[model samples]
Target: MVVALVGNPNTGKSTLFNALCGARARTGNFPGVTVEKKVGRLKLPTLGPSRSGGGGAAEVIDLPGTYSLSPRSADEMVSVDVLLGDAYGTPRPDAVVCVVDASNLHRNLYLVSQVLELGLPVVVALNMGDVARARGTTIDAGVLSEKLGVPVIPTEAHRRRGLEELKTAIVAAASGPALQPVRSLPDAVVAEANALEGWLSEHGCPDVPAYLRERMVLDVGGQVVERYRTRCTGDLPAHLGEVRSRLAEAGCRVPAVEAAGRYAWAREVLDGAVETTPEPAATGSDRLDRILTHRVWGLLAFAALMFAVFQAIFSWAGPFMDAIGEGQGWLSGLVQSAMPPGAFRSLIIDGVIAGVGGVLVFLPQIVILFLAIAILEDCGYMARAAFLMDRLMSRLGLSGKSFVPLMSSFACAVPGVMATRVIENRRDRMVTILVAPLMSCSARLPVYLLLIGAFVPATAYLGGWVTLQGLVLFAMTSLGAVVAIPVAWLLRKTWFKGETPPFVMELPPYRWPSPRNVALRVYDRGKAFVTRAGTLIFAASVLIWAAGYFPGDHTELHAVQAKMENPQVAADMSAEAWDALEERRRKLSADLIADSALGRTGRFIEPAVKPLGWDWKIGVGALASFPAREVIIATLGTIYSLGGDVDETDDGLRDAMRRSEWPDGDPVYTLPVALSVMVFFALCAQCAATLMVIKRETNSWRWPIFTFVYMTGLAYVAALLTYQIGSRLF
Candidate 1:
């Protein structure tokens, strides 16, 4: 048997799903949309002859949280299609579980009422009953069940209360007959819907469900009508207009009528079944909100909290990242010991191990970021944060919901792009996704640090409170965000042009975040990055390795490395002779890289980059780092014959960069050139993993490709301007 779980946002629906499914849930995207599909297997008590004494197995699909079945976009239509068994590759649900917040019963019942009209056997999980009680809202579950003709199970999902009863109800409902459709609509509306259903069946869309026919009559310019119009033969819009006209004549106007009828039915059912006491002037949450949501204090609190989160992501994850890097090195060393000096050994070490390590190095930051977001979100502070930021975001043609995602991009754009799912408006979500990569992530830090430390003088000002190097670092760090404002405005004005929708979100009462749910969220996000984005990063890493390794003979280089590794050969030589051999090896390795495919491409683009004060070596570093911004440090290290293991701060590598020059003996390391490099990396979309995540989130390669092209172009123009202007002044 298959069961579908549906509910409104922040109603403990996901909590319930996690409680029931535990670690068994698997998350994936829907057939053609980015909306997540989570399915898990459940073992139910046997009550039928087929099961005998054994427990029965069922598959439970947790649908996206929605306030209503009236979908406005293709993504929103997915939920309705899945419920109606019309979604491709999804089976018809044997039963539906409508999870509702008991404290907000009246408002939540709007969705429940819609579900009741689906003509499917449903079990209502009245979740958050404890919260309802705390709010002085008492609901008579038995009476509510009798009124709706469905079993209502009161559940506190976080506390694991009432889950067994909910499961039993689901099994019983799935085996039972489908319930009669709720009579929420007026007779005229129902009659018109039935007539329209017959008309659609005759007009080529024979499989349109009865519930959908009612929706077509109720939802004005909704997804249902638009979807069916493409399939129906002729004049479907005219037929719909005629039916709506007759219904209006009978005083049953669409859209509004549906809401009125559903609310009326809900009120009638709950007339004597619910009791509420509202006497408190300010509850605990309200009292805290006074300061937390204050214009001044709230912003301060949000800033401090974000600072902590940023620190955690930047500083806390360092040890883990280093450990992963060390492990990669150790593994490479072990492979060198176990294998011969050849192309295969280099492939295993450089292509495979290095690529996989690059991907894993990001896991720590991703985990910490998702952990912080999940905790903040589950505890209810996220809504207030959005509410506070709405005013500012509105000016950019976005709601406050875009703030968190953009802020998150400072840590990494992968999770930041994923976080846009919270924004319901499609235009706003797309805008957020497009602008997210502009936030300078941690990966860009190495590039900035290397340039500032190398070129920017340590001149002090303001009694040494600020130094030129410090100022340069700060400017580079903030450069992307400063540039994003105009980019966002331009994007909104052109591609995603639309009126910014008013931000309306319910601030759920503050409570402790459930650990189980937080862990699940972190695990799911981490798993997704490693499994989906990791594969692409790994493949790109291998391709880049092959590019730099090929089109040049490495036999002599391998022989030099083999001789250096032989202790017997090294012991017989004097220190001077050993030093000369090492130099020879370094020179040989450098020559091989310079003659490789990537090197040739770098030279090919040197002319284009010359205006930005960069040579072919700098161009090569920029191109090599496309897989990740920080890879430029290692790439530069290799280009200078200092080995790929050197970091941005390595003295030898820094000195080599200082000593680098053009054919005319002019130094390559200059203030303007360093600034140009930093500016380019700051504005560029250089991370392949982030691009992959964007592709996955948008469900299209077009956006990622567009992002890469636009950002690279923007980077080049900005870099050229920075160098040209700075050179003349300095």
Candidate 2:
């Protein structure tokens, strides 16, 4: 059975899901939307065992967190659909555990009242019970249970509180009546809507709310017509349009009047059962937000905090990253020396070792990246960061919530795009997804690192505090964000027009995040990264190796260069060794690649990029790295002098690049060429994983194609512009 867990954003529903299901949770983007869905399964904990016992586990789908069923965003619509079965194929949940924030009972009860109207069996789990008790609030659970008609059990899931009561409630209600409509409808509006619905019955408006038909007509200027004859539920009455015309002819706006009798009932139900310490001037969330959410200091703190995260990634992860890189290089060498110089050997050393290993070098950053992000999310500061950035983002057709996904894109677009699930609005989520690629993803980092290491002088700047290299990298990131804003605004105006999603969110009281919970999220995300690299990067690596390995050319020009640059000087050399040496020399020539399929293709494309200063070899590297961006660095590392002196710091591949020449002895990696390459990667949509994610998010081939075409076109034009502009300036 598919069970969906739903509650307000900060109400600990997610934490409870993790606690119940452990690592079985699947985190992925919602079908046709960038918003993520996390679903998992676990055996009913307190149940003795299934009576029919075949190990059929009860599955729980942790739907995107939502406040109420008002359905402002598509994200929240998922919750409503799951709850009311209003949306197609979303089964009315077998039972809903309404998780109410114990401390904020009134607001929490609003959702409960609306949910109760859906006529589903619901067990109210009053969450954060511990917090309420500590704050001197008293909850009469028995009386509250009596008042709601349905069972009301208090729970502090984070601490495993009230599990027994909640379990018993669920177990008992599994086959019982789940929901009952309680809110008495407005007599006149309900009667009018029912008459209209009866007349419009031929269309697909079956079971649609009465008031919705009027609002739909006013907003869309269309009747409730079936989208397709195949989908028509029944025959329509003749006067369906007449009913809408009459409402229009009345020409007076009518605001919805609430059924206060139900509110009065819910209020009377809770009045005797719930009580909080009368307004302590400032309490947990308010006290904490005063500082952490302060307008200026919060912004300052956020900047400093992000700066520290980046500092840690670059500085602290260096030794580990270097170790991985060196180890990979060493393994490649060992394989090359041991194998009998053939396709298998080349595949292992060049394709697998060089390609996959190059991508893995950034693993340290990946782990640290997600770990820090998860920490911020756990501590609940990520939400605050969004709240702070909302004002600035609103101008660009985004919310402060856009900051989290965009910031997350720094590590990888897959997860960042997936994180958009947290944004409630469909339009907001799509905008986040469309523009997230512009956020300087980690795949682009390798390209940036390569360029900056080669071109930008690393030295004291700002009198010594900021290094030039660091500043340039930071500036580029800022530039990407600046460019993304206008693009987002344009998208909103053109294709994704919808109301801006509401930004109001509850800030949970700050508490030290649990290490156990943090570790689980980090593990899930890290494992996902590893699995992706092992497949995508590993395959790309072999492709890259093959590009540079085959079609040996025994040319005197490249043989001499190889001997001069990478001469094998073994004293125990024999005739066999000499033969091997000759083969290796032939393999190292530039034209050797041209003879191979990959090399020949690069040669064919060389003319297209020759104006940008890249030779056939560079073209080969570029072609090979298409499937995986970072492997371009590793591809170059292996392609250039067999991974020797590939420091990428001072004198980064620069010496070898400078030594390279065309027929006219022109220098490679000139200022114009480097800028061209940087600009190319800056706009290029070149990641197998990212493309897969886009396909998954849009659920169609059309959108990813659009993304690729526009981004590639943009990359070409941008690079061309940069090279031309720089040639004149430099």
Candidate 3:
């Protein structure tokens, strides 16, 4: 049997899901939509045998948190389809578990009313019961159950309270008969809905549910009406308009009438079932919000909080990163000793290990970043952050809802783009997705750190409060965000022109973040990073290694390398002769690389990148890193003849970059060149993963293509300007 869980945002629905499924949950995108689908095996211990004649487990699908059943877009429509068992690859849910915030019963019941109309058996999980009691509110679950004609189980998902009862209720409700549709609307509206449903059956569109027909009549320009309009021909639109006009004349409007009717029914059912004492002058959350959400102080607090989080991400991950680097080096050494010194050795040591290890070193930073974000989100600070950003975002014709996604882009763009699903406005969501990649992600962190550490002087200022390197790092990180401002504005004005809607978000009462939830989120993000490194970065590394290794004879170079490795030959020669042999080996290695296919490609693009103060090697690294931005570190390590084990902090790779020279013997990398490179990567859409996610989220190649073209052009121009101006000034 299959069951669905639906709730409004901040109702602890996710926490409840975690409590119900725990490690059994797996996440994937719903078919044909970017909205995340979380399904888990729910063990029903109460029922000995499966109600559906299967195992004693039910598959629970966690639908997205929404305020109501009304769908404005295709993504929103997924929920309704799933409930109706119309979604492809999904069975009709045996029952639905509607989770509601006990503290806010009136508003929560609006969605509850809609679920009741689905004609499916539902078990109400009234969550956050503790919060309700803290406010001196008491809810009689027995009365509520009797009034709604369903089981009502009070739950505190975070504390694991009432979970057993909730599970038992789910089993009982799934076996029971479906609830009759709620007659919340007036008879006039009901008559019109019934007539419309019969008319639809007479037309080509048959089997339309009574609930959907009522929604079509009530939601005048909603998705249901638009959907049936296409299926049935002949003045359907005019008929809908007439139906809505008649409803309005009968003292019921199309959309507003639905809300009024449903809310009234909710009040009638909730009467005497809930009791509350007079509210205090100011609750703890209210007092906290006074300071936390203040216009001026709130901004400062937010900035300070973000600074702390970023600082932790950079500093706390150092030891773990060093450990990973050391481990990688040890493994490379072991491989070099065990394997014969040939093509396979090079592939293993220089290609696979180096490629994947280089990116994996940043796993700590990724973990710390995700951990901080998850904690902030769970603790309810992220909502306040969005509220604080709304005023600023409105000037760009976007709401504060766009801020959370953009903020998430700092750690990675793929999830940030996915986060855009929370935004209901199509224009705001699209604009946010297009500009999200412009926020420098963790992938660019390696590039920035490498460039800044290698080239920028370590000069301290403000009594060591800030150093030149730190300043450069901060600038590089902030560069993309600053650039995103105008890009977002331009997108709003040109393609996604629309007025910024007033942003409204619930600020859940502040509480300690759940450790289990935080750990699960961090684990998911870290695993995703590791998987990408093992797959995409690994493949790119091998391809680059081949391109740089072959298409030219390496026989002579290998012979020289072999001779250099022979200790007997080294002892046979004098110091000067030994030095000369080493020099010859280095020259052979360089010459072989210069003539290789990768070298040719780099040289071909050298002219294009020269304007940005980059040499052919730098061009090669940039080109190789297009598939994954962090691959540039491994590419450079390979290009400089340092094995892939070198990281941004590796003295060898940094020294190689510093010593690099052009044909005329001038230094290839300088302060200006470093700045130019950092800026280019800062603004570039270098990750193919992010672009693919954009395509998936937008459900179109055109947007991703447009994103790539626009961002790449922007990066090129920005780099060109930085180099040209810095060359003269510095």
Q: Estimate, for each residue in 1-730, the C-alpha lDDT of model 1 and write its tens digit.
A: 8889999888988889889988888888888776778899888877772212233878899998888888875556888999888888899788899999998888888998888888888999999888788878889999999988999999999898998898888888887778887878788888888888778878898867888888888887788889889998977888888888888888887778988988898899898899988573457888999999999999999999989988898899999999998999999999998887889999999999999998899899889988988998889898999999999998888889999889989988887888897787788888899989999998898888787888888899999998999988888889989988898899999998766766768888898999999999899889988988889889989998899899889899899889888879989989999898888877887788888999999999999999999999999999889889888888888889887778878989889999999999999979999999999999999998889888888888999999999999999999999999999999
Sorted on TM-score, highest at the top, how do the candidates line up? 1, 3, 2
Query: What is the Cα-based lDDT of residue 78 in candidate 2?
Result: 60
lDDT (10s digit) by residue, model 2, range 118-169: 7767788888887777677889988887778888888877776777677677
- Which is superior by lDDT, 1 or 3? 1
Give the lDDT of residue 372 in candidate 2.
Answer: 81
Clashes of each: 0, 12, 0
Q: Give the clashing residue pairs of candidate 1, or none.
A: none
| C-alpha TM-scores of all predictions | 0.95, 0.82, 0.87
Please give the CA lDDT of all the candidate structures. 0.88, 0.67, 0.82
Candidate 2, residue 679: CA error in Å?
A: 2.3
Give the worst 10-residue stretch by lDDT in candidate 1. 46-55
Best by TM-score: 1
| Local distance difference test, candidate 3 | 0.82
Winner on lDDT between 1 and 2 is 1
**Among all candidates shown, the one with the greatest lDDT:** 1
Give one digit per residue, the lDDT tens place, for model 3 in 351-444: 8887777567657776877787789878988889889988889988898878867876786776677667657677898999999999988789
**Lowest lDDT 10-residue stretch of candidate 3:** 528-537
